[model samples]
Target chain A: MIARLLMSLTAVLIVASVLWRDPAAPVAQPHPRFVKLDKHGNPLSPWQGPWSCVLDTTQQLVWEVKTDSENIHDGYWTYSWYLSGDPRTSDRARGEANLGDCYFETSRCDTQDLINRTRQAALCGLTQWRLPSAQELSSLVQAPARPGHAHIAQDFFPHMKHGDYWSADHSQPLSGHYRRFKQGALAVNFHTGKQYSLPYRNAAFVLLVADLPSEHHSSRTSGVTHQPTTGN
Target chain B: MRKATFVFLHMLTIVLVICSLFTGLRFSLLTQDWLKFLSALLPQGNLYFWHIGSASLLSALAAGYLLLSLWRPYRSSPSHYHLWVNRFGYLIILGLLSSGWLLWLGRFVAIAQPLHFYSLWLLLIYLLMHGWAYFIQHGKYVLSALLPKQPDKHSIAAVISVTAGGLLLYSAAQHSAETLTVASLAPEEFIEIDGLGDESHWQRAPVYTIETHGGINFDDGRSTIQVQALANSQESYFLVRWTDSSMSTNHLPLLKTQAGWKIQQNGFYEFDERTFYEDKLAVMLSHSCEVGADNTAQLGNRPLDGKPPNWHGKGFHASMDGKIRDLWHWKAVRTNDMYLADDNFFGPPAIAQQGQRRYTAGYQPDGKESGAYVMNWQWYKPGLVTPKRLPDQSNAHLSVLPWFGSTPYTAENDDFAPGSTLSSILYRSNRFEGDRADVRARGTWDNGVWTLELVRKHYTGSEHDVPLTNGTCMWFSAFDHAQVGHTRHMRPAILRYPL
Candidate 1:
């Protein structure tokens, strides 16, 4: 009797399953990317060294490559664009301690001064290493597949920081724009793909960009001057 | 008459067969084209509703049949192997249906997805066995009985009814398929500034050290950890050796059986798994964090000069805060067998209204129902006493859901085999839903020393978690046999480099 009942039940389920099956459905296909357009930035040519600097062809800029040890403090390093100033002077909050003073042969220098001092050594065989403008620095960012990390073209710039990096464009004495490796929180830089105007004194990762001859170069550099004065 | 009934059942079941076929279990031969064709011919009104409704009815009917088979005379019919197969088969169907309902509700995602998925395979196998048995026993006679002499009006009506019922069950089953904190501790141990001294290769060790809260006397019967910190470029290892008088593994449980309702008072007279709490260790981490404005998540005052406070905070955060803190809690019972610990943390709740309940974290195995919780039924029921039994006697986990008035485990129903005794150490099950925790730990005990290794990924990418760095500060706590009893220190220990 039990067998009879189950057999009948199974029979009914079979019929139900068939009725619901999708026969004419198209073959499954993967979802398309958001855009079909493809473009790879011009790779840096005339490049040199084990610490190879990249020439971003798309933006016509030279980048000083960063490694885990390139600018290390203990193991990882952090630095401010400037040491201290008020919110109006530099967009940084007061009471935050300075992580370090200056790394160059000089006694004291802001992130800009450090960059300027290092360029004299011609470490990358390129003496024009200047703090990159916020836009130029942002171009190197590829927002990592995972959060709390920076998306650098690691093959060229090894050991990109997951922390914020300093930008050369300073709107106030206290604040300079920085592009963080990871998104920030409230009362702090929050977005990953944009510039976070931080205090010049606040420590961050640094990546210098050297100008290259190109039509887009002028437009990109001049645009930084027009950006509204926003403090970090 | 039996033949007539069988014929009618066959006619009604024809619709079910169609529904089952539509499921495309066999190579999914029926495609969307077939579905489009059927939808045009079918009376469509929320197929999901009708399908689930019919399946529920079918499931209940099958359950009733099982209960009937268990009745006096039929219960003794051990010869009916097919009956037993069908009984268990229907039970699986019921489970599948229940999981389907839970999935629809968007509750217990961890448990329902797997249960709903596997139960389908189990049901299909049993049904095939059911069909094979009928063919084997009744043979040609069974086929003949299902075919009536002519299609009478009653048979035609039964067939139509079955089709409509099939649609309901189809919708019901599809409905089921659709879905799919930080604590601070202060541990104090004053080790040689160079973690390794006396030419012990501690050249690059950290310069600072930490002292425990109150400097609890090791001889005061409180546990003390002789700690050493070591870190190279790759990983950090903390060797914590603690002196424990006894090795305890008794976790509190509720046993219900035939004797009576008895609660084993933990450690009152003897070690009882139902009452004694398991020994535990917890670690929390934070990076560049100040307790957000909310008192719920504060770091107190750790001087930038690397100085800790005079007292250590105990238990959970005194207040709930919006900030994130990564916590790794080590429980002996859950992970010892699997070599995994309950990894948990404080984070934003999946739902908004849950409030602090969302503040809690736990583990339900991936695609499995097991979970771990420090607080259990012991919190509510108090003042019950249980007689001491052989500590080595084994205890079994019951499948009781508790609220359904199921028989609780008692000494009688929880029987001991005659002349045979098994160790009554501890046992657990995988039956939980929602809020899975993340953390892993391994611990070992010998003589009176407990050695534990707490490991977590260096980068968890969790906002609540602090990155493990040389400058990272941590607190510690140790608990012995006493339930909720933990020993902690006042100051946070800096993770100094091992010289």
Candidate 2:
């Protein structure tokens, strides 16, 4: 009986040890600035690399850009959230596709389907979101060697995949010219047909940006006060 | 104890044989030339026989050892023989895998050779076997551990084995650095010549030496020549000596011509005459070659009419003039009546000329002319003339409008009429005035195809008629073979408008 009791105690101790081994230790929490997500959502692995949310002032839109070496092209690409529900429904902010704007056309956005998607996002109070320009996307790349810029948020957008991301910038149609930012190397994509894209309703990732004030010329004698604002 | 000793020795022998086989093969591959020389000393077919014999012996030993290890009935006992074999085998496999992969991937991928693929397969198999053995022994707990864990006795052994295996593998891969012989040529090195009969050993003495440093270091020296050649032999001989400084003069040579001070050189000539402190010296030479009756170098019926022919043996005379301070500053002027060989004909062969009252400037192929004459000396520097000046500092007027093709005009007077058209204007300032003077002009082409004219206004309050000097003006024209005549003669007069 003593042996049985000791065995039982040992078994219980083993189970307790396994279960108590820090649940929160390896699983890091997302930064507070990031948008809240459902419980089932899992953040990117921490081992990946740096990630940022870039916000375009002209379009008032935000995008989640990730940078890592594991990507096929050794660059960064945008990732959009994939939510569940009617893609056009006001409450359906999920299931958005992560499409790259390698070859942009006004006709694609003006189609009935995209129009419906935009209307739904607007009705859902997502009026401030739109595609980012090529320049806006390139600004998010943080130079690892030089760290005067913003620090990479550690927890939420880790394991950022390195690949080509879509920018609203377009060249002549059929001529494959697109912008791609890979670890801060902004290059134009010559192959339009291979561009990737994501839907808007998805909860991928995004970067936010605000323009700083411009310097005033000393020659101007007028004592007019200047206010800084986000430039397009 | 005897059985155990035999087992250990057997395993050791197997490992040594395998290692030696790979090592020998790799050594033969790497030292191909050495091996070839050695083989020559042996009987013709004996080299192949010897290779087969050694390989067979090594394989038999390894097979025998393996068989002995497996023959043991008691599997539970930790045989020292088995342990040693496993340890050594693990190292050999790891080393071979890594070194082979690196070499094959780096060198053989571009060639797309069959041997590269075969070697790659062999390496992959070794890696897989090693991985399988590792997982089977460690179980899940240890398997989950990250690579390159802390070095203990097992890991230390692994490290050592891997290092040894790497060296052996590298040797077997047949990779070796190339050997090259290097020698330097200095300024003092003399080149000797032999067997030329009478002028047999004419010495070449380098005069001035120009050494290019930094990017690509090379020394090139020039020397004055004294020739001595055999009458029969086509080859000529000359003696050369090195001098310290350049011998070029920075002044145009005054030629005594029948046309009274007219600049004339037989074929082509170039000269630089400038008073600037650091003015470059100029040199010029000219030559002329005959072309076929077709007005072209008929080597292949190539265009010879004012165009450089694209063939061999057609001689071209080139005269270079410039300051001899540096080898890079030397400029050459080439002229050849042999058709396309000297086809760049927009103006006279002379680059720049100076006269007492009037100077005839040479024109570039791009229709821009530059020359200076005694125009009432105001400030010495010539002022520029353009159609319009932009506030943003953008030089939009610099672009040559096609309508003003080689027309003569002046800008001093508001002369828009045909005879009184301003071809060009000279800028001048009175001695009493502190301000400088400028000139400008404007006009249009007659045909719908060409229009837009301009002129300059001088501060001297003097008006010069357009096209008065030699019926030529500084204008812009395109280089089209078909439109050469029409383009050259269409120079319009410059009209001056009020500023």
Best by TM-score, which number?
Answer: 1
* Predicted candidate 2 versus true structure: per-residue lDDT over B26-126, tens digit per residue: 22322122332222112211122222233333334334435545664224344474465556554553444333333223233223222333443454454
* Candidate 1 chain A least-lDDT 10 residues: A30-39
- Across A114-208, the per-residue lDDT of candidate 1 in tens digits comes to 45555665543446666676666766666442223345444345445455677656653332233432222111221355566565456666666
Error of 2 at B404 (Å): 61
Show model 2 residue runs off by greater than 4 Å.
A1-61, A64-116, A122-125, A131-135, A140-232, B1-499
Q: For the second chain of model 1, what is the TM-score against the true structure's chain B? A: 0.39
